[model samples]
Target: MSDAVVGQVAVDQLLEVLDLKELGPFRFRGVSPRVGPQRVFGGQVAGQALVAAGRTVDPARLVHSLHGYFVRPGDPTEPIEYQVESIRDGRSFSVRRSVALQGGRTIFFMSASFHRQEEGLDHHAPVPPGVPAPDDVPTMADRLARYPDRAGIWAAIPRPIDVRYVGEPGWVAPGDRPPDPHQRVWMRIDGQLPDDPLLHACALTYASDLTLLDSVLSVHGEVWGPGGVVGASLDHALWFHRTFRADEWFLYDCWSPSASGARGLATGRMFTEEGRHVATAVQEGLLRRVGE
Candidate 1:
């Protein structure tokens, strides 16, 4: 199949995953992709939880921030039930908490805050200078072609996001990627999306988890899987600063400040191609060498 056709199919599948089924008041259920890892992807859960939270809030209120913790590995074969709590509904702001459960056990929980759009003083950090445009970077397929042995399941899976890495990805061989403190990439949903702002936010939430932790490994020239490091996301947080479409190209500028005791913390900023700083994400994960 052509890349464009594959991208559309992948994106349709992703949308299906994100479109949770409303079971009852403030409760929903979501499913995993038919083909994926044994464990559910963290981004799927986070995005579904956000969707649950967003459903209970006033449409006028837009989600501005979300903080979530991954408590246990999620089974891809089982359905996830998201239970949302209406924490508060103030005059200008609303808060909701969502808990994702499987077999009646909590797998993930999150607190999201929404706000009515209002005028505010605005200033944002500029995009780093000397970074190449999205088109100038190598596509994921191009990079993966160079390391076929390492591609493994990644090559077979459908990718919903078109990612162009500014430098080496985490799957590269040790020492192949020179030690770099930053991991920059340009990405966007592989297909077009509707105009709903909440949908865009939820979409970006799903995309956010894909590469944030790679910054930690990139800083040390470490890779993922056998002969390298393995990790699980412990917690994730995101702050939406402005409006942006998930289907359009955006730069993900990420870096790690510390990694110790088998844990790493990384932060990233998302900016539109026009240099509009739109969002920020922070995550900490448990990282350990294979068989450690």
Candidate 2:
């Protein structure tokens, strides 16, 4: 099959995964795509939990922010049950908390807040300087095709997001110098999505976790691979600042402010190609070098 076809398959499968089965007013069932190694992906859990929260709120409301924790590694072989509880409903604001479970164990938890869209004052930081335009960057697909010998592991795994790095992808080459504290990438869903805003938000939630943690790996000039290093997210938080679409390209600019005591803290901002700051995210993960 063609690259476009290959990309579409992975993302279409994820969209199907997000169409959760409504068990009741406050409960839903979601399944993990049985592909990624070891356990289910963290982004999948966060996106699903946000979808669960959105289901119980009024259609007029939009998610403004969410804070979530990765409680445990999820079982890809089993289904996850999402239990959402209504926290509060105000005139223009609402809150919901959701927990994702697998075989009676809570694997993830999230608290999401929603708002009725209204006109408001707005200001945002411009895209950082010295970053190359997304058009000039080499896409992940291009690099994988360029180096066939080094691309096998990545070729075998087809994820729902298409990512293009502006500079050196930390996972690419282990260099002598510890990288600067930051990294940048362009990203978007691999396939077209419907017009629903909530689905777009949830899709972005999934994409957010794809490479944000790599900011930590960049700090040490380390890569997570066979006998190289190991890490997982401990917590994730996102704030939606303005309207955006997941199917189109967005730039994720990330930096690790600090990393110590086996825990690394990283923050990121998501921007549309037009320079709108759509969302911002922060994550803390356990990072350990276990191999060469």
Candidate 3:
């Protein structure tokens, strides 16, 4: 198929995968991990919630920051209701809050802020250390190919995006030694994105949730065993640093600060090729490691 055909198909596929819906004062939909787990992915919830908020905001302003908490596990088979509250509309910025409900209960909640582009003082922390150049690293697709016969989690990962691991260890199974808690990877959509900033931003939101919380799971030599150690995303937040294309290569450097009390925290930063920081993300997940 031609690129246009592929693009069109991708757009439709994303919409179908997200399955967004409109309800009074809210948007409703179902998001799947694509894994067999009965619960939805937290990043999917955050991204979908952003889409819900985006629908209510003006086009002139684009989302720059968001914070969300996943309060309950959402049934993958049931649709999630996203209730959007117009928090504030100002001359320069607007804010919206979204709550994802399932079974008449709040499963996820998010607050997002949008802003019109403006010139102002700009400074960001320098990119962290030890990220491999994109050319030298193996893409996740290449890595997954190493396990062609393996099924389940490997098969569940959606392939709309390309990911290159900077320092990936224990990706397939537990290693001889304990796995490291920190990792670095680069990612982007496999195809080009349109010039529309809104679509690009939404795509970024969709891609941001991938592999975020799993960085924590890698550290403890804990493999995401099939039907074992039930895990779910608990909360996610992201800050857009500047305008950037989601189709271009961006580094996703991830690390886990702590994991305790059945929860683990993972943080990630996205950077452009020239080392400019584009976004930052944080996620906390319920890591109920089976057999304690």
How high is the CA lDDT of each candidate model?
A: 0.93, 0.86, 0.73
Error of 1 at 215 (Å): 0.6
Name model 2 segments beyond 4 Å from true: 1-5, 146-153, 176-178
User: Order the candidates by lDDT, highest first — what do you get?
Assistant: 1, 2, 3
Flag regions of model 1 displaced more than 4 Å: 1-5
Per residue, candidate 3 scores C-alpha lDDT tens digits across 1-292 of 1112223444445555555777665555655544334567665677788888888888889899999887887787777778899999999999999888987899889999999889989998888776678888985556666644333454554456666776543345555325776767787777766676766777777777777775887677666654335567777788998989988888887889998998889999898888899999988888875566
What lDDT score is found at residue 290 in candidate 2? 73
What is residue 184's positional error in candidate 3, in angstroms? 0.8
Give the clash count for model 1: 0
Query: For residues 1-292, could you state the per-residue lDDT of candidate 1 as single tens digits?
Result: 2233348788888889989999999999999988887799999999999999999999999999999999999999989999999999999999999999999999999999999999989999999899999889998888878887776557776689998889988888886878999999999999988888888999999989999999999989999987899999999999999999999999999999999999999999999999999999999999999998
Instruction: Give the Å error, residue 81, model 3.
Output: 2.3
| Clashing residue pairs in candidate 1 (N, C-alpha, C atoms within 3 angstroms) | none
TM-scores of all models?
A: 0.97, 0.93, 0.84
- Counting clashing residue pairs in each candidate, in order, gives 0, 0, 0
